[model samples]
Target chain A: MKNIIIASTSTIHGSGYLDYILEELNTFFKEAETILFIPYARPGGISHDEYTNIVKTAFTKINKTVKGIHEFENPVEAIANAEAIFTGGGNTFVLTDMLHRNHLIEAIQNVVKNGTPYLGTSAGSNICGLTIRTTNDMPIVYPPSFNALALVPFNINPHYLDPDTNSKHMGETRETRIKEFHGFNPQPVVGLREGSWLRVSGDSIVLKGHLTARIFEKGKSPCEVEPETELNTLK
Target chain B: MKNIIIASTSTIHGSGYLDYILEELNTFFKEAETILFIPYARPGGISHDEYTNIVKTAFTKINKTVKGIHEFENPVEAIANAEAIFTGGGNTFVLTDMLHRNHLIEAIQNVVKNGTPYLGTSAGSNICGLTIRTTNDMPIVYPPSFNALALVPFNINPHYLDPDTNSKHMGETRETRIKEFHGFNPQPVVGLREGSWLRVSGDSIVLKGHLTARIFEKGKSPCEVEPETELNTLK
Candidate 1:
């Protein structure tokens, strides 16, 4: 059985870092005394220690200690030994590149699958899917491959926004981009709005937040699924 | 001498395809009788013929014929003998993939460098940079490399948008994304607003439009440059 909380974002608008989800996290990480943090995403080019400190501050509110994976001699060994793991948000390309370069993809996947509590937000949640093709982050760095942990059955488009009718911008909308992704990819994609997350326990996956998620299938029109909807059949 | 028009977008808000820039294009491509269109980007998953037809309809207004490179038996040879080339906007990954797959990168670069008129919009314009790392498009497909045409000295972030002060969305702003790009890439990047373009003639590259373009160089604050400002010295 696997235990995970895959969120669309770490900090929602007008909220402190992970403040909105602290209550849920308190329960999600109840079994663990310390969390192994992976800060490789390095948002705004912040150093690993700086990012880890941010995570540590947030986890402290719930009485859980946090340590960055970089602190360990071997990241693979750290993941195997961790009681719980939390990966924060940043540039998906950089996160994926680091994950591949460190060869931590399988180590993390294996432990998470074996029931080590896990939490991922934004770029972190992106790697929990089948591939990083749906990530909104720029290609700041090239990873060895687009393959991800495949902890979930389909791909995830985090920080997903609906089309703004009043906007004058001509760039492709989030819906249009996912439609374009389907042109080259056949896997289903879940458009996860901010404050929303998927709670995975064993083989059951359910939408946990108040907002509805937009589900996109290859040949069908995108439709909104209500909160608490089971998503394990999304593939 | 190279004569190229690299635009941020082919269609701006509330406008028909290429309507805003057709007048300028008439003079820019005056000597070319037919324009070779590269429809590899395939916006909305439209077929090559359909995408080419869209371009053909727009070019016909300027009294120019348009033929897709896919129409030719050999895409590389098609670029070699073309009087002019036009690569329209779509997905950058797909566009770069096809360009590399058909071995047209060097062919197009050679012809453009020798004064054959060339035009690129959005994804097309993205390829004129040294790499596709700055593109805002989703990575629907993996290309062989992020390396691009290198026709220009710096990368281009087409459809550049400023931070929305009113929006509650917490995703990284366009400026933040570019700033993150600089953390790894040393090259300067031009944030081209819609309706703005770069006019490259020989060794001189000038910004051409009514609005100012944002220039982002590594290790310095981003600044706005006036239209008609020379950009060739940005390396």
Candidate 2:
């Protein structure tokens, strides 16, 4: 059975890194003594070592050691040998570009599907979808392809925010962007609000958290689904 | 000599479509009797005819006729013979994809370089840069390449927003996103606020509109430049 926790973000507002979800992660990663961290996203252009150190500090709270894939000679081998894997948030395009360039996409996908416990937050969670078409991040760098792990049947719009009726900004809302994605893409999209996550076990993908998630399908009106809902039925 | 007006948006809040810039546009396109409209962006997933009709109504006020390039049997020829060209805002990925698919990138570049009057708003303005790497739009579709017109020396981040100091949202601020772009891209970027534009006349690119534009250059602190400032010195 596949075990995974795909979170909208690692840190919520007014919270430390991964602090809000540390309790759940303690149980999720209980089986593993160490986690192999993929810090390719490099949020805010932080160095790989700096990014990995941050993840290490967070995982330490759960009594688990963390090591960055960059420290290994072969990333594919690192994924294969990892007891558990945790991919942190940053720029999705940068993360995807590095994942493709380092040939870790298939390696990571194979291990995750073959029963390795996995955790993905933000940009990391984005790569678990069918494609990165629904990401809100700016396209700082172009990847070889928009194709992703296909770990889930649908795409994810992380940090999903609803339209503020009082705001004067003219930019497209998170919902509008997803609708635009549906115009060209056929996959269903989950607008994952902060503090929300999808718990995947075997063939079951259940939404978890107190807030509701906005579900978007091609040619259909977007609807809201409550927590504990089965998202695998979206397709 | 290049004559172009690259706007941050087509409409400001509480305003009709192109209402604010119509007066300036009237004087800008005084020499042209007809405007060839490229409605490939398709904001809100509207059809080409519908998007073109909106532009037609706006241009009619200036005593100019508007025809969508899609109406032509040969789009390449349509660009070569047009008196003036206008590309409106929508999804940047969609617009870039169509521009590449129809092989109009080179055609548009040629005509514009040869002194064809050009106007681009939002996604259209995005294409006038060196690459579409700084766009805020979601990657609804993959284009053949990120390379753009290179009409100006630097990239343009249209509809630029300032960071909300009081918001609890954890999403990356606009400034942070642009800074992230600079991490990978060496080109300077202009954050053109709503109602702001870049007026390109020959080799001089001047900031227009009342609002001050934010300027971001690689490895430097972002600064604000007042309207009418010449942006050609960015590089």
Candidate 3:
């Protein structure tokens, strides 16, 4: 019985950190008293303590204590014993590197698989997918592998933006990048725009949020799915 | 004596392939009879032969013959013996991976260092830097390492874009991304806008084209570099 929230971004425009998703998070982790934050992504080059403090302030609204994994003497043990978990947004490559190097992937996967409520946003959400090949972040660092949590069956493209047809930019559009990914990889990818997320409840992985998420499957035309759509039924 | 032309892109808005830079290439390779093309960074998923054919057509405008390295029985020999070389734009990760996997990084570097009249656009141009860490392309594949040619002193951000001050997008801007890169890395980065290029002749590397390039160094404010500025003097 996995309960997870994979969001496209942490702070939406005109909103404070976690303010947009706090209500859902409160309900998601109501039974839990503490959350172990995985601040390895280090968004904007912030330190682990600084990133965790940001989460701490947000969790105060939900009456939950927040602690960073870096605080523990044994991070793996801390993850395994945490009442809940969260991986924040930053550089996915660096986050993956730290996760793999610390040998915490399997431990966190085991905990989350065993009913630990998990939350991830942006680079964090990218890891819930089978692989991180669909992320839009720059490759600032090299991780051992592209392999991720496989918490979801497919991949994800966070901060997914549509191609500005009128713009003269020669760079590949987000859709084109995902399409190029499909050329070498057969796995499906969901282009989740900001404020959109996948709410995983047991076997049902539903597309939540107000905006439509674009789905791209191998050799198939990409299509948009409405909010509240159950993605498990998608090919 | 390294002779290299690292261009931001192969095609700019409303232009034919390599048309903007063809004159420079003609003068650059005036004495060369045949040019060895590296189509490993196949743009938009084009096949090696197909991409090479495009280069062939363009080279015809300058009365020079073009041959893809893929067509050779020995790729290493083709690089070592080439009169002129060109690595086209596509994916930098794939290009770096292929260069490393085939053990061609050193080979290509050796020839370029010995002065073989090199031309690189986009992904190709990115490799001329210290590492491929600043490329704007998607991480469709994981290269074994982020290291690049190091032919130049600093890293290059090809197709470098300025942040749209009025955009509502929440995703980190290109400037923000580069700043984050500096947080983790100390290497200097040059944001080469489309049509901007670095001309390396002997020990002096000069920024060419009309547009100003953005330079990002660790702990220093980013500054715009004028056309024809000497980048070799940068920190």
Candidate 4:
């Protein structure tokens, strides 16, 4: 039953984008009454009415009732009229190019496979996964490719850092570019640092974080998992 | 058991030391007679007698015979008096900081597990991986951490480019820093593009290359594998 959390930020919004977090996103909408915000991913430089008035001041401090996505030209009927569906965070290839030019990434993957209640932060938890390709930033900017939201298979490198002792910024870090992407492809990465997050529910997949997340797999030996644990698809 | 050939380049005998691909490395040592040139990794400004006379002009164009680790004061007896050790590509953190300050990365992994004959071009095939952390320039420069030449378990991002559709370079494009290094680690990458190479001989592994090698993996679906195939590794 699709309960999805997918964070990297809900309040520790970091480097501004309307600094979010709001008590772990109001504990996933406390009880929920109306929380549909989608901010059409800050398109045209910035104006979804200032990112839906910062998601209407975090759903008016948990009172709920927020609606954006430009009052719906039919974002799958405003994400099927919604009971939850949050999705904030900026610039994951500019919100996956406005969720693939408003096709709403397969209608938000069919309203989270009909279970609803999906919430995302930080480039909206990077479109659920399978191919945002890992994302730390600087593809220069393209947006409109749309193949993620598969729920999770690979690609997430969010805000991860630790090789810097002083910061000269030359190139390569983010764990040596995911260890040079395991030298081309073996498929199994996690790196998720920075306060971390990944809930899911129902099918169960926790992994919160304190560090020691590093997985990397190709031939194996880069292991370390131990946050909330539940991930398993690197076969 | 260890018939390695990791190469990328070696022809500076005159003093130039930095950028050398030199005719795909003199057609990869023409017929290989006795190629043993280590040149301790240049970059901090050459002079190991101009980096072993640029490995004696790429082993005198196949006439072979280039010995340098300061003519072996014991690099495990010059990598066990090689029949073929080669290792050429610059700045992989200054060739892993002179093979970990001359301890020689476990004496070149015990001279490739005593099969000897190993050769690694281009940052010496990224020290045969387990942790060069996948090189693509810029650990900025520190070296001597050791633990590569695992023959393959993950880590080797040699040269691999692909972002200049027009070119400006603000950053973030080796496929978005390797899909943000798969969101911080799910593990599985291999973008190896640029004349490519991976030829181990004992347990047998091959993947030469022209194009068509991009695999990602975490939740799955970034396919494309052509070269020589046979690169499994999931454990």
Looking at model 1 chain B, report the run of 10 residues with the lowest lDDT sum.
B96-105
Interface RMSD of each: 0.6, 0.7, 1.0, 14.9
TM-score of each: 0.99, 0.99, 0.98, 0.29
Comparison by DockQ, 2 against 3, better one = 2
Query: What residue runs in model 3 are displaced by over 4 Å at the alpha carbon?
Result: none
Q: Clashes in model 2: which pairs?
A: none
Task: Name the best candidate (by DockQ).
Answer: 1
Q: Which candidate order results from sorting by lDDT in descending order?
A: 1, 2, 3, 4
Is model 3 an incorrect, acceptable, medium or high docking prediction?
medium
lDDT (tens digit, per residue) of candidate 2 on B1-235: 8999999999999999999999999999999999999999999889999999999999899999999999999999999999999999999999999999999999999999999999999999999999999999999899999999889989999999999899888889999999999889899999999999999999999999999999999988999999999988887
Which tens-of-lDDT digit does each residue in A28-112 have in candidate 1?
9999999999999999989999999999999889999999999999889999999999999999999999899889999999999
In model 3, what is the error at residue B97, expressed in angstroms? 1.1
**Considering summed lDDT, which 10 consecutive residues are worst modelled in model 3 chain A?**
A176-185
lDDT for A158 in candidate 3 is 93
Error of 2 at A175 (Å): 0.6
Residue A30 shift from truth in candidate 3, angstroms: 0.6
Predictions in order: lDDT: 0.95, 0.93, 0.91, 0.61
Instruction: Note the DockQ of each predicted structure.
Output: 0.90, 0.88, 0.78, 0.03
lDDT of 1 at B233: 89
* Per-residue accuracy of model 4 over A1-235 as CA lDDT, tens digit each: 6777776655442243323445655776676777888864442235667877877865676677777767777777788767788777655666775677767777777777777878776667766866665565422234445356777666555555457555432334566656654544456666666567777766676777465566676666666688878884543
Each prediction's RMSD over C-alphas, in Å, is: 0.7, 0.8, 1.0, 18.2
